[model samples]
Target: MALVTGGSVAGPGAVEAARWWMRMMRDPLATYGALGRRYGDTVRVPFGVGRALYVLSRPEHAEHVLVANQDNYVKAFTYRPLRAVIGEGLLTSEGDTWRRHRRVVGPVFAQRHVVGFAPQIVETAVAAVERWPDGVMLDAAGELRRLTLDVVGRALFGSELAGEAGRTGRSLETLQRGAVIGTFLPGATAKRGLYQRVPGLGGAIGQLDGLVQRVIRGSSGGELLNLLREGGEFSDAELRDEVLTLLLAGHETTAASLAWTFVLLSRYPAARERLEGEVDEVLGGRDPRADDVDRLPWTRAVLSEAMRIYPPAWTIERDAVDGDDIAGVRVPAGSTIAVPPYLLHRNTDIWPNPEGFQPERFMGEQQRHRYAYLPFGGGRRICVGAGFAMLEAILVLATVSRTHRLDLAPGVPVRGRAEITLRPAGPVPMRVSRR
Candidate 1:
């Protein structure tokens, strides 16, 4: 019989080990790195008497786990906590609901649709840039987060959300930690209750719910809410789930990705110079339009390289459907399978000088393996907004690069906190000056 591991056991790979649980509670990136270094890529950490985890980082392993034989796995137990908070949203839902959500929401993120949203994106970036005072140090991460949240707000729901950015930002922080906490507890019901009891999270979910309801009610023009409301075969609960998913998923990640890109550019002057040249040539003197993105190759490449190094959607995990061997270890059914993009992107076998910042890695006809560089993930469940995110990030980066140069104040240590998505630990302090 295939083993189904879901409990505490202090054996060869005990997930209950203090170090393992500490890593789970605190720093997963370091923990994963230590595990990979110590036991190789395919280390299994036992959870209780039955459940265990398999952390794999190689390209072939990622391919086999996330794409090639993906049918053998389902979204891992880690996502379960996130689902509890969002509830059947596009990112967390599975089965027929996921298919239907994908079908209806997919078109809105098409290249044409995404490109058409560029002007709005530029307008939002410009507006945020306008508020920045020279010599004034601000949280660059927070600012970009606000800007992208506003863009997602206006583009998807045709509503303005800049005012709620601060409150919403804080709320999301609480909700993310709660997601990890819920993963240890049993069932979605436990998570839903925990979210209510948590202070910042409870307020945040309430506000997000309020905001979504307003958007759904107030969307007289946008395609997202309309498609969600009138789309056939979508239940009301599923619609809310998807709306919440898109609202959070659509913006938070792109915002964080841009934040990391700008931070990297500030630290790397040569890279910034190249980015500026590309943007200047493409845009000339006018604001960019949907027709203009294709010509901005270097700008796009810079964004690509940025995501490769610090992918906002940094980790992808799955659980085996049936007990099976991957790489070498025989993973029991119900075991969590982790193939972190953060770790995978840094795999030296696939990326030369993996930790170095080099936009040129994507410049020419470099033959890259299909699953080697999966910033947007792979397989049927790959991020539906991948196209939209790329377009948005590139356009925003170009427009901002054309107008302003932001640098983190010296000695300001920027740290990333892992959440439902990876984000700056707190504020990313930077000085914004006109380019």
Candidate 2:
């Protein structure tokens, strides 16, 4: 390991670069972890065509890139494959389009308005848990996906999406895998049309399209769909893209968070017991409301800790449009900056016992850096569904934790799949037992 200071950047040597690229393509998380350990937080790797990628994991680095100097950057070209699938939706769109979509779509996910969806979120979770037979092994990841899909369907779109969860989940897996593979290919940007020509990629896009159409046609006229339709800001094709983007983004991240929470709790019985105690004391056998989120600090802490360990939106990237400096690292124009939460959250310098699961970090009024924990990213382009996500996670965790506990099935060692989102690699089989 070496110390990086002053204006000079640090990274792998030319001879080591080939090995680094191979490791990155094979397993990005492990590669990034290796880079952090071997070269410190800010490693400047040579990218294609005389470009450099600076992997930044510090909190101040995140603030510098995502907040203060955001105007000098754009969503990196790495997101091109994603833009291919979802079109110019909120997640991949930029400039005037992003601004306009944010303005139109932001109101629906506002804190005050999202609270109104609490009843639906709770009811959906309760219904799903009630159907689980005791002592039977269930896929926690799949169940969470189903539960979240239902919540977004009923609460946001007034549609029943639980039926399509299985197909939708598979479709997302294919698309995400393809997107990641696409990033490493030469001339990946501006090749959206070529993506569909790939064997399985086209079907993945089609599956998502079918789901969006079902939502639009079967929607009992939810506020979001209505706004997208009546606002006249988006054309018909653009309307479908926006709806599909919300459907995928709205449910996927929250589902991943809850699934990871369940997995973490299973591994740490004490944390599980403490969480159950906190939920029991706070809710008192009643359904959780929006206000109850604040009262249940431990439950929220458990989730925060889970996110710290495995943030769903684990990586954030930006391309420098102009020369800039991040934490004294010289960044030139056209450079790519990767602010990975996985690395930042696990940085030993910032977090004591970095690998340990300690929910208490979020329980007290302990002071920390502002950009230290960015599960939802930073700046104006932060996740709009953030408020909705936390509320839904707390309520669902409370609702399910009240009556049952999910323990990992014996001999099943869950591995994380770092695709578009950081989630369990395969089905997370867990036994459901009565509390």
Candidate 3:
């Protein structure tokens, strides 16, 4: 745990900088989690020459960097590799371009309009669940990915993307691996061209490009597609980037959330029983509807608690545009700040019994720091599709739970892979049984 900065030990540096970097490159999620425990909420380590990275997990730190005094921060260089892939899409874009794109696309994800897509979400989930044969082993992660992709495809683009879900998932795996590697390489942002020259990187981008082309060419003329097309605001490339961003962001995180939910429910059977009971009571053996979302408090809480435990979008990073104080940590200009939800959500001070699965924590009225639970992030850049994601998760969980229950394969342990998104490292094999 020696702390090293600028290749020099500070106050008997508990952890060497090179050791931290090695650990980070190997498994960043565990490294960050351990740092939070050993060094409190904010840990600073010099990274790559004179630059430093501040690992800040405190809710106050998140609020300061992402919301209050937010203008002084921008998406950090860590996202540059992603920007190369997704281009200047809403998720990676900055400044006026981000504002313009947000304006053009924001309304469709508004709560009122998002609720309209619940039927499609539920329909897709039900159909996918129906395909699951009882008493058979299946990969819950893959199934949920297919379901969410289909939901986004039909609801947003009016296309059938379930067939492409597996391919898209593979491509994302490659791209996310490349992105994480790029974050540690020096001058990666400036040398994106060189970075792309690396083996397999080009193929990953090509796969994503091909997917976007298919989405554009096979458009079923959905509402969002129509807006992007008829609005006359985006060029062809811009439109492709936006579609790719939505296609990836819209499904991958939701799939991860659902996947983790199943894993947790399998481990905590009592919670699973309560969840099934709630779903049965709420829907009464019928398909879930948009209105039923409000009536299914436990379902929503289960999803909430799942995301709290394994947030799909686990980490949020931004570069300091100016020097300022955050949660009493001295942040210097040009430093990188990492507000990781994985650590924040598990902070013992913020969440009692942090490691335990208790969906009831989200039930009823409970007072807590706002940024402590940012599965979708916080501030203006909070997920544009947060409402859609939440509603989709609730309905899909309810729909699937109503008809079937998934139990993890005996003696199997589910470990998370912290790539661009937090997801099960390997197949989450589970036995499905008709309820």
Candidate 4:
């Protein structure tokens, strides 16, 4: 493969790249946007004497790295911290391990099978929403987190996790923040044992371990859990890892997307009104069912649009296993490439008024590239729970919209925190009122 040659490639020099890296560590989402604007789609920032981290924003680049020539890439080293925290679960494991885990877990999330969980999802959401006091200010983010945790726990693990949501949320906050810092640490430091000794991370990991243990000990013969146990494929440690991975990834991402949807609805009342009107027309004051998901087009579109704006899995990164030319830029082996959905979704060329919240973009037949709006990523490594998540979000949104309206608390500032996921920086305070 040819070296990154001539003016065709653009980026900062070693010194400048070092500075950019520092800034990225501080505020990655903003820094990535700034880099894209300053350097165009493909920007190569040198890491050391030979290695480079390429920030590729184009959909074609995403398609190439994540799909077409995916064989030449693996999850980037940036995922090491997360792997250390979650262990060799589906999210982090590679090669035969990943294939084996996927084989065991994939069937459960099939659209046909996933629909069976709809009743549990709807029931959980309705029960949670009923508990919300009318005309009171509450943290929408926290509430959604609890609701999602409970749904995943009951639907998948046969455990009730609503009570654990508060501590789990705090632990996740600490773990995600530390994971970013841990990325720059030495390789060996990614070990679970070493992390257990760190100040905040130690406690966070302990809390997660306790939660996973509770799930394992308290499981009530959930189908997925029974399948894993009866198969005899997973060892004790592997089971713990996979359980923790599912518990965190499955719940956190969905919660974040729902919270963002609520935030966007509050900010754009017109969109909220249309969404409410759609819910009222379709469900008629009844809790949403599996079939109701397809009937609520606007609700689904609103969730899709929210995810496009604040993709939970904000970045999809890979490390090259061999030299290759991506589009026209030459990439050497061992190069780190980030194809962030946050950037791709907001690419002005593909999306008209990219920053605006417009559910209509997702309502009808769309003509954008397949890789342009990857809220759940692409190719084989795409989120395994994608179908399940969409189902849960649509149902939960419809259920909530049927009986309640949550308005953002006046004068509160909401911001995004870019960690393992892109979620609200703090509590998303919103006032709830009966519809």
Candidate 5:
């Protein structure tokens, strides 16, 4: 990394260049793609304030930076803004604080406890399916959001948050969009102020804050929220941080994951038929339970294949704390490295017919590197909720597959957008028919 200083003395173009870099960062895929086409994968957008962004999008680069010499990288400055919003949760905190938070929240997201939540997830999905009207076009993305939100609410806090999810969903959209942009700007009192002034962002934060407080005060289950409340390891502010982080992370990502899964299913009727048959044969119109996840391998594989193509948590970033060598490129200290699952999963070198829908690729044994799939990420800092989210998604998928078949409306284009997560920009219109 070149030391960038005294450029402002040259001209106003330096500052304008910085703003241009920021704009490009706001939507990285398009920016990165264009840059990669122009200057290959390692393109640095010089902000001219000793804070340039080096966007690298490849598997070897990702493996080297995110996992193999992981100690040299810290969460990028971009995470600082998300940290202000969520506090000392697993996603944002650094060093000991992150380690401690992970230790406390980690065990609950382990496979056993995560699988334990499958029953609640299935119940929620079954309940949603029962409400569907035959041949009625539905916003599948929104429906999946509601389902995931409900499951996260019930399974995490033992509360009925479905009623709040609609408002919460809209609010969350504003916050996510704002938070990413906000991360770069130097703000005063990021926790207590700033966002409070933005209309949708502020109002959404308030609503989310209130909910976090309520959950922290009293939760109905032995979920992570209850454990956090009972442990009293954090103060009110700290507790609010973790709760909000979990809510923001746990709900939307899972929702997008399922939404994409259903869309792919709609496009591939043969796959859908196979999936529906499996659900019928195993679950038999009953809701899925923890014990049945193993039997529903195709259901799990369908969701896996969807994520490989359209990962909700599409990108990951880390700022190098020290200079390191990744494959052959020399990364100097303070360089921001990107490991986007979107590109890695689509890498034609690793995945044959990468753009096609092929759940059969996941069948038999996976011979690829564990890091090769990487939807939930990898190593010690990998998503703590990976197991929990998978269990919930599979369970919900099974329950829905067993009870109803949703057909896509004729020729309705599937639109996608990349915010903090990659989501369908518009509704996924599909008609519901009871099984």
Candidate 6:
């Protein structure tokens, strides 16, 4: 297949292309940002001899690849490493396997159904927040991870995971780092057995395996778990895969986004005040219910703006199954295209003052392109847990805002770590004060 020729190539020469590849392996988010700044929205970076990787940041690119002509694209080769770990779960599975998993797992996250979990989410958040001593400096990222894990555990699996969050978080860090590194290795290295032989990854996998087994064996008949067990569709191995996928996907992204939201609120006190004002006026010192989400538009907007700035799933990539013209760019079959939300949200053409933390952008009416703000991706393959995640985030944010305020600890440095998810690189040290 011929490489894409229509778009401006980021690194046209072989030597420059190799440098770009090395930069990508080292820091993908920074590399993508630099490529976008230099090459504009659509950039074709030469991969191998005749192959090219297209970094498309335009909303139209997202619309075409993820929606309009979506059938022509499939998840890219980058997901292979993740697949080896999660097996045939929804996040990595494709074709018939994906269809089957979605069929069984999708309904639980349906808007109406997800609302049922709101009580559990808020309750878990409140309990976790209450445990924090007044005016104590804590790792907001770790705390949020533990809280989200607990919510997902009790709400969906009827198991308690708060105790395991620390180890699970470390395991996930190892897995994500390993997965990214594994992506550059030979195809055979993507195998689960091969990953198991790797030093730290083996223990990480063991921890995750132990967690999944705990959920399966210790299940106390939570609705989602009951459905999965009674459905008679998934075998033991498939059940383990789905459970692990849900556990990780359900908690990790939400935790990261919440941690970022807290950090952003700390940095931008005016935004934080506005959010707290809205939460106070709306809730009046009561825990947030699902129905309260609509009334508290500013809370939702804060979460939206936070996600816009630091999207958990920063990149969405796909490989073309057939050659086609995406807008004006000619993409050949097998071409890999990345429609990164991190770049799209920051595309100056679409978002004015893209670097600013403005929750007002999501308020009132939005006239931008349908694919412009893709915190949850687009098209049929969009995250099934999108509704659930949003509901959980809003409730947790509102619940925390109702009684507590978190500010970045003095002189602490925070940086984004772009791996499987875009989360804070290290602990987000923040002091929590009771409001």
lDDT score for candidate 6 against the true structure: 0.91
Stretches of model 1 off by over 4 angstroms after superposition: 1-12, 327-329
TM-score of each model, paired residue for residue: 0.93, 0.97, 0.96, 0.98, 0.91, 0.98
Model 5 clash pairs are none
How many pairs of residues in model 4 come into backbone collision? 0
The deviation in Å at residue 358 for candidate 1 is 1.1
Location of the lowest summed lDDT over 10 successive residues in candidate 3 = 6-15
Model 2, 41-101: lDDT tens digits are: 8888885667878899999999999999889989998887888778999999999999999
Q: Give the lDDT of residue 370 in candidate 1.
A: 74
Which tens-of-lDDT digit does each residue in 191-233 have in candidate 6? 9999999999999999999999999998797888888889999
Residues forming the 10-long window of minimal summed lDDT in candidate 4: 1-10
Order of candidates by TM-score, top first? Answer: 4, 6, 2, 3, 1, 5
Candidate 3 per-residue lDDT, tens place, 192-234, comes to 4765677887777777788889889987788898899998999
> Under the 3 Å rule for N, CA and C atoms, how many clashes does model 6 have?
0
Model 5 lDDT per residue over 1-435, tens place:
232322221111355556546655577556555555554545455553565566555667778877788888888877766776667777888898887778778888888668777667777887888788887899998888888888888888887778777887887788778877786686465554777787778898788887777666666763777777777787777778787888879999999998899889989999999999998889776667888888988888899999999989887888888877776666567877777788778766689888799998888888886677889887778988988888888888888777788788888888667767888876788898876
Worst 10 residues of 6 by lDDT: 1-10
Q: Candidate 3 regions off by >4 Å?
A: 1-15, 188-196
How many clashes in candidate 1?
12
Which of candidates 5 and 6 is the stronger one according to lDDT?
6
Tens digits of per-residue lDDT for model 4 on 1-435?
123332467888777788889998998899999989988888888886688888888899999999999999999999999999899999999999899899999999999999999999999999999999999999999999999999999999999999999999999999999888889888886788888899988999999999999888988978788877888999999899999999999999999999999999999999999999999898887788999888889999999999999999999999999988887778889999899999999898998898899999998899999999999888999899999999999999999998999999889999999988999999999999999
- Regions of candidate 4 where Cα sits further than 4 Å from its true position: 1-7
How far is 35's C-alpha from truth in model 2 (Å)? 0.8
Candidate 6 TM-score to native: 0.98
Evaluated against the true structure, the overall lDDT of model 5 is 0.77
Candidate 5 stretches greater than 4 Å from native: 1-26, 37-41, 187-192
lDDT of each: 0.79, 0.89, 0.87, 0.92, 0.77, 0.91
